[model samples]
Target: MKVIGKHLTVDMYGCSFDSLDNLEFIKTAMLEAVKEANMTLLNLSYHKFEPQGLTALALLAESHMSIHTYPELGYAAVDVFTCGDQSRPDKALAVLKSFLKPEKTKTTNIMRGDFGSQKDMKPRIKISIAPLRRVRNTSARVWSLLRKK
Candidate 1:
């Protein structure tokens, strides 16, 4: 079996845009981003939210690219995620920022998937998480209460 995986995280802020109500413009931009990422697009869905703004999504074979626009506030939220090639998402994100003209942008990257990535991946028949602890001790309960806050 073979495994392939890549992870990327990008945070962008203070984006400047000409207008949010323009469906054609934003839709074009979204399509460009998907193509630039080298991902095959299966479908694209977009609509104007009205009063507030518009939300758009590009569904791709790798994953998805989405954006929310707030023209009134001169802001937008963008996300590009893929699993095959590591730099593809970031490259797409760069293209998006360049066109969107965001004032501020931050990015963090991390590997996604198991040790072998998607290779030999299978759904877990059983799930195991944190062991349930017996809550009889007063001090333990008090500690748990404090942690929750």
Candidate 2:
């Protein structure tokens, strides 16, 4: 089997509510994690939801990393995917864990771009009707209009 990249998905439970809800803290932690993992950051985006919760994403040269938090549930979901050996996705996850201080964590590692052989590969088809940005903008506009009523 040939592997091209590593993807780590983490589910953190019993995390600090304050830390999960803090947008600045999450942004800072993500930046630190990117640096620690030796990943080149191309862009970063984050949003804090009304009432609570937060979401952040970092676009890296190697790949991408993201975090979504539910403060009321004391949980955070994190994803780190990196191509090439120079970047450490595990190290990035570690940095997030340190900041959130979760009492329990469940992690899964997936090897990306791994295809054993022609016979072993299964054919699959995916279709997208609209770009993500367009969907998001439309949804936001609808939500805003509903809230104004």
lDDT of 2 by residue, 46-103 (tens): 9899999999999999999999999999999999999999999999998999999999
Model 1 Cα lDDT, one tens digit per residue, 1-149: 33344545555566554555577878887777777777788899988875657888888788877888888777777777676653388677777777777777667554455666553354447654434344446669899999999
Largest lDDT belongs to which candidate? 2
Q: Show the colliding residue pairs in model 1.
A: 14-103
lDDT of each: 0.70, 0.93
RMSD of each: 8.9, 15.0
> TM-score for model 2?
0.77
Worst ten in a row by lDDT for model 1: 127-136
Error of 2 at 136 (Å): 56
TM-score of 1: 0.64
